[model samples]
Target: MSFASLGLNQTLLDAVAEQGYNAPTPIQTEAIPAILEGLDVMAGAQTGTGKTAAFALPILQFLSAQTRDSSGKISVRALILTPTRELAQQVHASVVKYGAQTDLRAALVYGGASINTQIESLKAGVDIVVATPGRLIDLMYKRAVDLSQVEYMVFDEADRMLDMGFMDEIQRILKVLPSTRQTLLFSATFDDEIFKLSKALLKTPKLIEVDARNTASIQVEQRVYAVDEDRKRELISYLIGSQNWQQVLIFTRTKLGADALAKEMCKDGLKTQAIHGDKSQGARERALEEFREGKTRVLVATDLAARGLDIEELKYVVNYELPFKAEDYIHRIGRTGRAGGTGLAISLVCEDENYLLQEVETKLETQLPQQWLPGFEPDLTREVKKAPRRNSRGAQKQRARERALGKKPTKRRR
Candidate 1:
């Protein structure tokens, strides 16, 4: 349905329309109404699903309808906690954009910036505060900000926060917040840990899931290349140059690898930059800005910078190194194929990562077609065997019985 039918204020609707959003996305369609109803919500939707606007719009509406404090001091009524500085800034931007015509004031506070400036902004007062967990906790410890009156709280990218090891900080923050406030938890995927945390944090929450796990976006065309470990960089360079690809994202496993790859690509006359946690905030922001503006042809990033990266028309994603966890493979490729747009995801697999690839294929419930470069075919005589699959107790007993009966045991394909 059209965003106009979502009961958004005319000014907010105008803002959305100006942004060229004619219809609500699935996550937005389900989340906006539940949020407006003041119910706790837990949403499972991938990045680039307009999840930010889902909660941002409703929070803006709620804050606008409230009466200002008698002292004319704008105490924060809503707190949005995000995992990364980039995601925090993005959510803050949406809040400001949608609340531009209203009386609400929003501010973004995160690390890698001067705490003095954030403290000054807190003193000036704000209606909504978007922050990272660490910096928010620091501010609260110094009594620089108060959340006792916070009416709404949001944990955007909840799984990412958990991955970053912010569980203690999250619990501490929750302890300080008012128990009567409305809560919302939005994540790309749900695991046992996230489910347990949701049970503790939400009160009979409305559940919204737009896609099932193990389902990658259909808009993405995925391919895998079997290459030697040493030839991966050469193959990547050749592919980009041969295809004249612009705006490609390359993922590496470590910060050093990301930096080295970007440097080598630059040496090959391609504009490139590396973004990771080690880089200063300004450097990271500049790199992202250049990449978004199409000034940089390639951006090499580690896993930390990979999550919550929203780049429009991102044509290609290359997995320079496969993650150890199979689930992360899904997230890596998900950087592309955004917003129902066609994209490509390419993975470079070496001998060492063969088992990782098999695990990933099993998790996806589909076998990936492996392609060999004309001159890069691996040696079949090497006999590289993966570790044997683990068997359950019942399966082991059945296998023993078949062996005793002189019958071959059947293999169960994952």
Candidate 2:
């Protein structure tokens, strides 16, 4: 249905039209009406489902309807928390674009930027504040921003925030917000932790799931190559070069892996750069920008980019290494096949990562086709040595931690 039917005003409709959106996405269609009715909402929608507009449009309309003080002073009325800087910036841009016709002012705050400027913006007054948890906590400590005045609160990418270990920060932020306020949570998936979080925060919220949770976009063509660990780089290089694939986004499990793979690809004459938490914010943004502009043909990234990096018409994604979590596999390939564009997702599966690949297939509820490229077939004769049998539980736990941290196992201290 059209956004107008969802009870948006002409101004909001005009903004939607400007963006050439005649009909609302499923998430928006379900979420906007419930939000306009003043009900708390917990929505499950993957990336590229127009979720930003679902909340932003309704929020803008709600804020615009509020009575304003004649003194020209602005008090924060809404708080939108995101997981990462890139996602924060993306949500902020959506707010500005959709609220362009309204007088409500919005400011963005996140880490790796000038806090002084953010403080200045908050001091100048903002009706809405979109921020990351860490910077928001810093601003609260400095008394530069106040959530006590918040009438509406939004946790965008809630699952990702919790996955990144922001549970304590979320609780702290919740303690500062008004006890009696509307809350909205949007996430790609809702595991037990997210459900528990919803119970604590939402008051009989309307639950909406736009699609089957944690499933990859159907528009993406997914395939995997079985190769030896040492030959993964060679296979990927050949795929990119032989297929003439432009604008490839590659995901690895660690920062060091991202860096090393980018270097190797560049040595193979492919324009490549790596982005991860270790890179300066400026460098990260520049790397992403260059990749988006085609200055860099490949972007090797760790899980830091699994959710937030948005590139329009990004047609190719490579899982240079699979994530430890099956849920993240969905997010990694989501970078491609966005906004109705056809895309391709390829994974290089070595023997050690076969279990990881199986886990992803289980989550997707379908088997990913294995394609063995000519001249890059795996050396099946090379025997792999299994780790020594120990206490299965303790050994598995240690391996799990190492996989999550993207590190090799370290010996225990005496």
Candidate 3:
């Protein structure tokens, strides 16, 4: 169906046409109507699926229907929380573009920038605020923003936004929002934590899912290579050199690993860059820009650092090292195949990481096809893990909780 059929007004439809979007994605098709009807929605879709507009349009429509708050001013009526500054900026930009035809005001707040400027912007009283949790908390403490009038709340990346790291901050924010407000939770992937948070936050919410849970995009060609952990860097450089891939995104597990791998790739005569939390925001943005512009052939990054990274036409993603979490495998590989584009995802699995691979397989409920590259054969004499996978937090917690009850916990996947 068209955007017009999704309960959007003529102005938004005109905006959509101007943006050159002919129709809504699956998530949008299902979510916009329910959200406009004032229903709490929990939506799951992969990256680059136009998730921003799914909730943004409905939010704008709801706000446009009412121009002012009880104080006869444009107070903060909607709040969109994201995990990274890049994503917050990206979402805010989309909001401005969609709401351009209307008079709705929007503000952005995140760390690593001058809070005074954001404070000044909030002084004008915006209708919507797209912010990262930490900086929003800073604004809250400084009394630079007000959220008591917030009627619509959105968690853009629920997986990372409500994880153990940000849960405390989320709790602080949730305590301030109106309890009767409509909440929208969107995530690329889901786990036990997401489910628990949804239950605690949403009230009889409409569940919207595009594909099967924990599944990657079908447009992507997935493959796994068995090589020695020590020679993974060599294999990666050889693949890029032999295949002549100019734009490839690599995933590492830590900041140090990303930096070291980037250095080695640069030494191999391949232009490379590394981005992670340890680097300044300016450095991270510069690295991303250079990589996107094809000045760098490879970019190594950790999982957290890669959130909200929007790269159009990216065709290759390499897991230089497996992540400890299985859901992260899906997120990392998701960087390549986006917006219905065809791409390739390669995972370098050594013997030590077979357990992690098994965890991913369990999460997907299917085994990834494995093959060996020429001259990079691994020693097949060693046995892979025969035990049930238990690397995820849910499994660990279940084991502990069961032990307390004098019972054995069944093995579970992420």
Candidate 4:
């Protein structure tokens, strides 16, 4: 149905029309009515199903309908918490775009940016604040942000927030918000944790899911190529060049892998960049901008770094390395096939990562069709060799414990 049929005001309808969306997506169709009716909602839709607009529009409408004092001071009326800086910025952009026709004000707060600037923005009085947990908590501690006035609360990508270890922060945030406020939770996937959080956070919420749990987008065509780990870079380069793909988003499990893959692709004469937590926020933004503008032929990124990437026409996403977590596989490939666009997701599966691949496929409930490219087929007789273990957090903690006890660190048992 049209957005107008969803009972949105003319201003919101104008914004929607300007954005070239004639109708509500399934999530929007199910969620908008419930939200406008003052019901708390827990929504689950696969990536790129217009979930943002489902909550954003109603938030704008709900806030705009309220009476305000002539004092012109702003206290946050609504708060949207995202998991990452990129996602926070992405949601803030949507809020601005949809609420442009109204008198509402919005601001974004996240880490890796100037807290001073965010403080100044908050001081100017904003009706809505879209923020990441860490930065928002920092602002709260400094008394620069006031959340007690929040009438509506939203947790975008709730699953991702929990995955990033934001549950404690989320509880802290909830404690500060008005207990009577309406709450909305949106996620691409749901698990026990998300369900438990919803039970605690929402009061008799309406559950809206457009797709089955843990399923990938039907619009995205997924395929896998069985290749040796050493030759994955070569296979990706060959596929991109031979297939004439202009822009591609590639996923790697580690920051080092992302950097190395970008370097390899660039040496092959393709413009490429890597984005991860290790890079400065400025560097990440610049790389994403270049990729969006078609200046970079490839963008290699770790899973956590790619959240909140909203590319309009991205056609290709490659998994150079499978993620340790199955749900991350869904989030990685979701970078493509956004906003009703047809896209392709290719996985370069090596022998060592087969177990990870199996876990992902089991969660997805479908086998990714495997194709072997000429000259890049895996060696049949070779046993799958595991990569050298990196010094992960657990390893680092073990070493720290040994150091504290005045003992030499032993090799990990992995």
Ranking by TM-score: 2, 4, 1, 3
lDDT of 4: 0.89
lDDT of each: 0.86, 0.89, 0.88, 0.89
User: How does each model score on TM-score?
Assistant: 0.91, 0.95, 0.91, 0.93
Candidate 2 TM-score, C-alpha based: 0.95
Q: Which scores higher on lDDT, 1 or 2?
A: 2
Tens-place lDDT per residue, model 2, 249-367, is 99988887888889999999999999999999999999999999999999999887646888999999999887878889898888888877889999988776776787789898999
lDDT of 1 by residue, 319-362 (tens): 98777667777877888888778889999987756666877887
Candidates 1 and 2 compared by TM-score, better number = 2
Please report, as a residue range, the 10-residue window in candidate 2 with the lowest summed lDDT: 388-397
Encode model 3's per-residue lDDT on 182-256: one tens digit a residue: 999999887788999999899999999988987988888989999987789999999999989989999987787
Stretches of candidate 4 above 4 Å error? Answer: 384-414
- Candidate number with the higher lDDT (1 or 3): 3
**Local error of candidate 4 at residue 334 (angstroms):** 1.0
Scored by TM-score, the top model is 2
